[model samples]
Target: MTSATRIATLVAALGAAVALGGAAHAAQGEGVSEVSVSGHLPTQVTVPLAGKDRTVVRHEVRLAAGFVCRNAVTNRDLEFSDLNWCSQRSRVRAMRRYDGMVARGMLTAEAPVIVLSAR
Candidate 1:
């Protein structure tokens, strides 16, 4: 094959590999645990990522009815919206009722806007 053809093929393959790698990361990314943040929520959270691979600081949170978490860094109040209520949600209750903002994901917002779902 010509050198130009070979180079083009290599570039295409490299691009494909990079795309697939990103897709895998998206698939492997940590999912939001079925939980909510307590009232007067936290402004920051220290999330342990990838099987204790590393820790990340997250800000901005979504507090549901029964969230039992807090950020050791910033003490920001969480305003919750909507969330999935499960049968095993015996721990979540009122008093901790937040703004009910319908959301999911980490107790903080260092990452993208993610919401949790049972399905």
Candidate 2:
């Protein structure tokens, strides 16, 4: 994907993360162990390239609630990572998923790391 497209995607993902994080915070004491997020992950993604666009069908990724690492400074920076979500474990799972997303290019390599604690 082009740099612009990557940045845009990163920004949107972070926006969702922030909103969800707030909700998670509010609902922390409700004994909610798991969360599900859908619609964001698509089977096919249209990526813009040089004067043209291409479509890529990503493999099925199970949805689960996990921690998201976003740029601590700002969302304008295309540097962040997130775990799509899954079974509730703890910080260990969140950290693992965070690294996994970064490896998958779902999050930027240089994005500042801020892992929201599991509630």
Candidate 3:
């Protein structure tokens, strides 16, 4: 075979390999849907009044935030391997809830905020 023909064949093989590699990579990701922030429902808490035995029921407030990966076909949540996948917006929302809980006297300001995925 001529040198020019050999080079051409090699180039074609490389191109085909790259295309197949990309297709395989895409196929591997086919099961995963777009990433999204997980939803959390608020819970009511009963707290005793300071210096008194009386307790009161506080309003509902969210206590955590999380990231969720779902299946593209079924829309069901799938396990994620890393906490880094959680978005900044989700973290900020959790902080807001924590602050609200403190402001409403449901929690103390020194309480730690919870991350659902981290737990």
Candidate 4:
């Protein structure tokens, strides 16, 4: 009820707000719509992202040799005969991409985005 107490409370509230905003901003730096999806993988794989303010739509498909994608940049899927085994660097980059994506609105749920599901 005192003037001093009110001022102190105001200052504390402002600091807390600043801290939260900073944390949220730091979490989402870039608007990563989808993962670059480099490297290699057996079998067929396709990742689809729903529409959002960030981007309309995105589809990254990696199918078997015979499988094919009628379209690459659109709703259509894609297939590659040979896998690109670049290096662990690609994996790291993909992981970063996944993190950035989760930070952004691309991924809403709190789950493992980059799942290295190998058989």
Candidate 5:
């Protein structure tokens, strides 16, 4: 095969592999029910000139069928702080925690509203 043809074939194969992998991953969570959870939590963040500060932010938790957050506090209003989930470290941890919950049938879907403790 020509170089161009070989490259195209390889790209197609890779695309197919990725599609299959995604399908498999999605299928693994099929038939699961999720709950709409909302709450707020306190997260520390650094201000440009104000240094470090603690803020209460709103977050949503979309939990899958069988998973649950033992420490999840829901239905709380975002009155404490005016910020959403901020800070890279805190955000990553929150995402990982949410992903873990979803993986174990806990949650899915996230948005900025109310509060859902992802800590």
Candidate 6:
């Protein structure tokens, strides 16, 4: 094969591999857990992330009910991976708390905003 042809093929293969790698990451990403809050509500709460002492701070939001409220984590970096990882970990921790609340009959239908504070 000509040098130019070989080079073009290599470039195309690399591009395809990169695309597939990204797709795999997207597919492997964590998903939101189901936590039904029928009535129990807190103005603010702190949820510690799994395997880490860091916690996520969640503020009560009127627009989104339950776990859909806005969230932030303590000492979170602005970088892409840092932001995404912190957010994901916070979400997971919140869901776990919600599940516990449900199990313990803490969930209510009042739909009040719960503020989650972390340090």
What lDDT score belongs to each candidate, Candidate 1 first? 0.35, 0.39, 0.44, 0.43, 0.40, 0.46
Question: Where is model 2 more than 4 Å wrong at Cα?
Answer: 29-119
Which of candidates 4 and 5 is the stronger one according to lDDT?
A: 4
Error of 1 at 72 (Å): 18
For residue 69, give model 4's deviation from the true position in Å. Answer: 40
lDDT of 1 by residue, 34-112 (tens): 6875654332222222222111211212232123332211233322321223211311322122223123333343332
- Candidate with maximal lDDT: 6
lDDT of 2 by residue, 41-74 (tens): 2222122122211111111111212212222112
**Model 1, global lDDT:** 0.35
| Tens digits of per-residue lDDT for model 6, 1-119 | 99999999999999999999999898877575778764433324533322222122233221122222223222231333444454455455665666665577554544422334321
What's the TM-score of each model vs. the native? 0.27, 0.24, 0.28, 0.26, 0.30, 0.31
Identify the candidate with maximal TM-score: 6
- Runs in model 1 lying further than 4 Å from the true structure: 30-119
In order of listing, the candidates' clash counts read: 11, 5, 0, 0, 11, 12
lDDT of 2: 0.39
53: Cα error in model 2, Å: 86
Worst 10 residues of 6 by lDDT: 60-69
Instruction: List residue ranges in candidate 6 displaced over 4 A.
Output: 1-78, 109-119
* Over 4 Å off, model 3: 33-119
> 44, model 1: CA deviation in Å?
27
In candidate 4, position 37 carries an lDDT of 73
Please give the distance, in angstroms, between residue 52's alpha carbon in candidate 4 and its true position after superposition.
38
What is the alpha-carbon RMSD of candidate 3 to the true structure? 14.8
Expressed as tens digits, the lDDT of each residue in 75-98 for candidate 5 is 233222322332233444554654
Return the lDDT, model 2, position 43: 21
